[model samples]
Target chain A: MSVLIFAELDEGALKKSSLEAIYYGSKVAALTGTSTTAIVLGEGNADELAKAGRFGATKVLHASDAQLNEGNAMAYASVVAEAANQEGADVIVLAKSSLADSMAARLAGKLKAGLAANVIELPDVSSGFRVKRSIFTGKAFAFTELTAEKKILAIKKNTITPEETEATATVEAFKPALNDTDFAVKVTNVEKATGDILLPEADLVVSAGRGLKGPENWGIVEDLAKALHAATACSKPVSDLDWRPHHEHVGQTGIKISPNLYIACGISGAIQHLAGVNSSKVIVVINKDPEAPFFKSADYGIVGDVFEVLPRLTKAVQEL
Target chain B: MKILVCVTSVPDTITKITLTDNNTKLNKAGVQFITGPYDDYALSRAVELKEQLGGTVTVLNVGESDADPVIRKCLAIGADDAIRVNAEPTDAYFVAEQIAAIAKENSYDLILMGRESIDYNGGQVHGIVGEMLGLPSISPVMKLAVEGTTAKITREIEGGHEELEAGLPLVLGCQEPIAEWKIPNMRGIMSARTKPLKVVEATGKDTLTHITNYELPPARGACKMIPASEAETLIKLLRTEAKVI
Candidate 1:
């Protein structure tokens, strides 16, 4: 028995979420009495690929085809399925992301594997292989059992804590059979967000709603985000009004995030908004309304006006 | 272009999540259902494309009769027709198999769906269907435009976006900014009453997974109130007590 983990790369560097997956996979391998092997596709530095060992993989398989870097779901799934077969893996683990989820769907179909998406906890091997996952957009949880011979898990980001080791993985060159059909989706251009943290991957997030009034008042939110090196997000109304980009909206109808710290300013906690961020580890709500529904779900609360509270909070963060 | 857009009927986002039947099923007593928010984007884009490209848009749902009204809403929003696979949509693989079987029979020129259903949030059907049909799939597509037989797509990625091109007969999982959600006009709603709604039996029976139990997340303790005048202390608490920074 073996575990195969897909360590996806972003612009030639291993992603933090991928490292977390390797660590999570190693724990599963220990429970199953198997070894963990990490398969890395696309173009990446050899040294960076070897960091898989630092997170817990015993071996690293590097598939260096340039076409693998295109983010084609079908092609990536084919390569991952091939790696799983070659490694004789019974379980495949991956970090949850748009790219990973897309590939996992095809991987499940190709391998006939039982896939559990958005898995939040390690499987309970004490009984059957059961996994707990978030459902209803993180409003509830479901314990699901995989009934297939092969299994795939797409674990939610930031759910597991990773540990580093001094160990080194034995890197091996792996070349999966490829053809022109594998590159069916042709990538024309790539535009990467420069300098700003992406909300989905952020650890700390500063968010607001209509309470900030207009788009011009966003400087306060941005100031706090810059001080803490966090990402900026808004409630649905802010995005709907075009005060912020739709991508920056975090709510039931927008991007769902589980950042370690989520600071909401001037936003009333509508049930829809809470569904998107209720899973956040620590929530701080700053609202003038004392009866705001968001305060009930918050770890901390400040009853005050946004105009007065935000600048003070930004200064406090800067002082720190 | 013949477009197939798959949608899911989910409890409104404002509804509190509650499970029944010994915690194995969602309680539907008073819950109102709507098209999955992400799927609404896909349906809107499909309608827009059909208008610009001059084609028919058919919406499909893998659910029981409870989803018929939701599927009709799709038609009211300008879908040419509708299909509902008669099943409970228990597993992601099972749903994908049904969709793939239907797609094989129809041979749609383009397939679209939301990134994932809001209830299950699997986000897996599109690629699984594409794989089963031997077609390429792009997911969480934010922007899509078709010229001739080629589609220029911009998909969301971690930290940024990527622009790609692919031919027709492809599957795409769409999200926001692809198109605005379309509300049904009076004429559209009236015409939907007569639109063909096909009901089909599911061909797939093998479910790879099952929910063993359900759980609600633990309720948080009372919020520790911090005075606005002493906002700096909150940061200190975050640093020293929470240790997040």
Candidate 2:
């Protein structure tokens, strides 16, 4: 009866969400009177893997398989299940990353574990294991009880805070038996969007909507985001119009974000849009229409033309 | 090519989510149900592939009679036929099991669905079904083109996207940019009335997890409105008062 955390990496470093999952697993281990083990299924720095203990894991296992580095869900699931079995783990914890989304279900199916995904809080294990999670794309929440003997939790990002300690984990090499069929899906090419803060992990995000008018008017939004060192996002209509890439669209059907601060320019708050961003710590709406639905949900608001207000806000952040 | 596309009915995106039945169920009164927005992308792409590759496109749903209209909508949009597993899709695994059972009975070359259903937002069905059938499951697919038995796919990751190649008997969870949403034409709508709609009993009944309760997020406080000319002051407020930036 132990907790196993899958420590995912970004550029050979542990992702912030994965660190939080380590902490989350440790907390669950403490509650259940068990130890926590962190496993890196792919290539990762040995020194960085050892730091999993700082986030509360008791030990770290490095698979160090180059084939596992690419986002291959089937192969990843096989390795994770093997690691869990070897560690005698009944609880598997993972960050709700795209990688996790792709593999967690496969892992659950392989291990016959009950999975609670998009979990936002630690489980209440007083009786049956119940976990709170965001549902309906952040419009509502649900408390679900896992009834299976083994449990899998894919926790949402920016929800759990990671605490560090002075301890370093003992790192050991681990090899999991693999099946050839697991590598059927071949990753032919990898293209990473460069030079901008990744929206999912960005602390602050600056977004605009249709009111920006055209693609050329996006300079002001970019300027504001650059000044604040924030990621840029746009509404669904903007993406639908080809004014921005679909990846930059933030809405119920698009990328949902819960940053520390979210600034919206010239965007009326539709429920679809609000569903994605209502979880932000602070929301600022800048729209010409005072009656724009966004103001009702904003922490701070300004009724003004985006063309005028965005530059002023950019200058202010740059000055700060 | 025989493509099986799974879809579900969700509360309209604009519907204000409300709880009823002692907070254990969603309030359906006055709520309009529509095809899951993300699933539309999957259906459209599947239809496009069938047009290009000379194959049959079938729509599948794990739901009760309430989902018939939504499944019919898919047929109207160019799905040759439809199947509804007569059961409530109460859990992700349960739904996946039903899908896997159907896929086994009929060897679908490719299976597609939304990245996740809007209602549960589990995003787990494709992987689970893929594992159950020993097929490759790639999700949030933004671009997919098929040639012979191979599929050229691009999927969204955290920061960017990845291009991949997979043989048939693949499961993909699709999203936008795969293809534009196809609205039902008048001719298609007329023919949809005569399309084959098969209703099958659900094979999987056990749900590993159950929701104990539903909750609405806390309400927002009053907005602190700043004058248009004093937009910079809002930044100071964000720094000192909100302290987020």
Candidate 3:
């Protein structure tokens, strides 16, 4: 038996999260006594794809097709299902990133496989496939069992610590059938600023809320983010007031991020917002109110004005 | 144009979550329920689109009859009608099947819903329904503009947003700044009671995944208060103690 891991590429390169996923799949493959194979659909060369070996994959199937240039969930699922069939993979692993969850869901349906999304741990494949996941907005955990012949697990990013090994993978060419129906959504334009650390994948995050006052006062937050090479995020109210982009909003109703360090400036921690960010390994809060709810959940708390504390913290980080 | 919007009712954000029946079920007693905050944006956007583009917005819920107030709120926010599938949504795939069945039966040009419910936070239904119905799906769509038979959609990618063009018969999972949250006026509230609220029996299907138990995350320790003047110390701690910087 083989374990198939979907290794999505960004601009002809493997992403940090994808590498973590490969590492996770490799660990689980070891437990199951099965070899791990990575399936790359989009850009990247075979030599680069074989680098997945360091993360536990023994074989990399490169589906080098022009039609697979852009992401289409239906077509991606079709290719993944075909790859699973060709490799005789009983367990499929995918990263629970944007568009990947949808692709995994569709593949689960297409293959009649039991799907477990947001999986945080590897299953006991020695017996039945069982996994753990966060539920109730991170307030609770749930143990799930997949009963189907095939199991698809979309592992959450940053949930697993990656380990590099000496194993290298062999690259192979893969081709899957495609149809016009897969091209329903057409890409009109793709716009992304070249080199900014995205919030979803950042190791450190600096966030501000209404306490920052206005959009004009975002300089200190940006400076701190720049000094630490971290991503910037905001509370829901800040995004609602158009002080920041909605994509930067991290709350229950917005983007949920799990970073190594999350610094909140001038934001009172609400349960909704905490539900999104409480998963961070370390949280630091800066607020004038000592009784701010965010402080209760923070590892470190500073009761001070954000305008003063933010600039000073930025300067200190710069000195470091 | 006919637009279909899917909504899920969830416990209010402040509700203390507890599980019962050996941790297999959520204890619903005395818990306050509200329309999902993210979904409100979708329903409001659907109403806004219907007003601007001339379409009938229909709300669909794969939930039990207890979700009437939430469905009525969708109507109050300007959905022309609502449909409730009388089934407890057990899993994401089951809910997706219910939505796909409803969408297939109706001739909706556009399907809309929140990116994910705050409760389960699955974020899988939109794409699953779209794939089941053989339509394109765009998720966490932050910007949408409909003109003629095409809609321009913008969604956040890894670093920034990607602008795309999709024809009718598409599913869109919406989030904030796409449309502002709409409050129901007095007239709308009164009319909401008169709006069509159809309840249908469940069309059950095979479920592949099951949750066996539930447990809460470990509580975090107390915060270490730092004086405002110790900014450099805090940075040093972050580097050495936290090892985050």
lDDT of all predictions, in order shown?
A: 0.90, 0.90, 0.86
Off by over 4 Å in 1: none
Clash tally for model 1 = 0
Model 3, A1-320: lDDT tens digits are 89999988877877778898899988889888899999999767766686798888999999989789777777898899999999899999888777687688678767878787777877866668789988766788789888878888888767799987777898888978887887877888887767888777788999999998899999999999999999999999998888887778888877778889999999999998998898899999999998899998999999999889888988888787
TM-score, chain B, each candidate: 0.98, 0.98, 0.95
| Candidate 2 CAPRI classification by DockQ | medium
Better of 1 and 2 by DockQ: 2
Give the DockQ ranking, best first.
Answer: 2, 1, 3
- Model 2 residue A247 lDDT score: 80
Off by over 4 Å in 2: none
lDDT of 1: 0.90
Better of 1 and 2 by TM-score: 2
Residue A209, model 3, lDDT:
94
